[model samples]
Target: MIDRSLFENTETAFELKSDSELERAYFLFKMISSEPLVRIGTAATNFALKAHLPVEKLIRATVFDHFCGGVNEDDCLPVIDKLYTKGVSSVLDYSVEGKSVENQFDNALAKILKIINFCDEREAMPIVVFKPTGFGRFLLYQKKTEGVVLTSEEEAEWGRIVGRFDAVCKLAKEKDVEVLIDGEESWMQDAADDLVEEMMRRYNKDVAVVYNTLQLYRWDRLDYLKQLHKRAKADGFKIGMKIVRGAYMEKERERALDKGYDSPICENKKATDDNFDETLNYILQNLKDISVFIGTHNELSCYLAMDLMKTHNISKEDNRIWFGQLFGMSDHISFNLAAQGYNVAKYIPFGPVKDVMPYLIRRAEENTSVSGQTSRELSLLKTERKRRKL
Candidate 1:
């Protein structure tokens, strides 16, 4: 039985950061907590880059440095070492988005292989993560999901995409590293899911080497989980999944409204939360055949997981369950969970400054949109700052 107040210890959570780092985080969160400021800042940053102004260095030092590991694999070694010192695992995510060429796709696959090899040696990096859109054309995947038959050229292009995915999973199997395929916008998710299921069917026979992310904000994901579980169980394989509230809510609703179809997302925060918890319960009940990754920032959801674990008599250090939060946010949850002997990991994204800008922008928008997320983080940082007399 773990104490409920375990996450209240801010000192241990912020111990790795210096006084200056904490101060910078406080100021950054304060600026982004306001929706209007985040809106203006994003627009200004985009404009500055377009107008050939010198903003990359400033962004690199501020948000990029705060949120990302570095611009490359070698740059992430030190960050990995630092997190390992605190008993937290790192998932190195090659977070460059908006590329669809075959060359770029191959390059992404190669870098991911490098990451798998890097983790092959380091225990701190237990999982590798990359989104399907990073290596596949979003439009092509969307059309495929819509049941459109591709022409010969497009078919060849998709063949290359599948070939790249096969290489990643094949190497992951050999290297003994888990690869998490991130979820994307609903329009293209069906194609991604189909491909990911194929990967899991091929690679997850003995172990959960490949994971598919499920967004609980969707209205049908709870049922989807049950059906997937049935398939996995019958097929004699384990299923790996990362559960989240999702990232593309605004765009999802807008697109559904534009297309004259019902929105796939939940109706409200309560509905999302309820479905998420129920899904967690369902997964927990089948822990022997399923590996679940809880990727959330909500403290209540975290507690619910803990209670579920206790009820199911699952050990805290069970490798089948992992708690993940993004780097530079939710330190209290990440660090405290690690301290409690739980299998905890942090998502550390790395790439070139320009390539990673989209991820950084999403982080800013998430802080602004998620109710009181930035404010709660700021409060914890302020408390730790005051405690240290910084």
Candidate 2:
């Protein structure tokens, strides 16, 4: 077993932060912890960006700097190297979202190909990630999921989407790097799943070069995991599964109500947490057929995986299981795991600041620790600050 004080070593956790930066992080987290501040700040920030105001500087210095790696791939190299020094690998995520055109699709494809090619050379970089909606049009994918018959133009658009996907997967296979297909809303997820499944059949025969994300907050995902494992054994291909608690909670429930369909999400956070842990156990039990990236911020779940690894006598450096956290959040868990010799990676997202604002706002709102004591993030910062006496 690894040293447990690694979790309490706030000095290492905040090593990259200056005293001023630490204070700013505390102030920002405190602001967003209040529901009213987040609501007003989100609206005002959006308005400023849209109205050609100079809020970009303030934003770049605050949330954007904290959550995102850089404004583009080249800009992230320094950050990537910094993480590597402390034993954490980087997963370069192209963060541009909500684009829907052939050129944009092509650009995203080329960008991911660049990431994969870059990963081919860097030991510090492990896996690469991209969302289905980043390049493909959301409405078109939603229609395809709903089984709408596509006109010829829409069919051609689908072809472009498929080509872009195939191109990325093929390169990943050739380069011997894993590519994670990030998850999105349920309405369009089936289309994305179908595409990822096909890619797996083509590239995952010997090893898992392509991965599909499963959000365990969905009530059906446990059964879905069973079906996937059974199919993988029958079909003779490994399944690369990245598991997370769902992201689009309110959006999923709201749309289900509008459409008069039963919601796909778990009824409560407890159910989601249970299902996530159960899914993790199921995957670890069947380790040969399934490889998982435990993409979570929950501390208990992380420790549970550690205990399971110890029970199974799995090596700390095993390639089949990984721990992933976003770049800025959960530093104690990430750096501590890395220091303990586990395979740990940070999802390093990069893009134009405006294009990445949606992602930043989501991080801000989701991380607010209004329920009780400070958030795991805020408290860690406080601990580090007190240790340094800055």
Worst 10 residues of 2 by lDDT: 367-376
Give model 1 RMSD, 1 decimal: 1.2
Candidate 1, residue 365: the lDDT equals: 91
Report the lDDT tens digits of candidate 2 across residue range 258-287. Answer: 999999999998999899999999989888
Instruction: Give the C-alpha lDDT of model 2.
Output: 0.87
Residue-wise lDDT of candidate 1 within 1-390, one digit each (tens)? 557887778998999999999998999999999889999999998888888898889998899999999999889889889988989999998888888688888889889988999999988988998899878799999999999999999999999889889999999999888889999999999999999999999999987889999999998988887898899988888899999999999999999999999999999999999999999999999888889899999898999999999998999999889999999999999999888888899999999888888889999998998888998999999899989986
Cα lDDT, all candidates: 0.91, 0.87
Model 2 ranges off by over 4 Å: 1-6, 369-374
The number of the candidate with the highest TM-score is 1
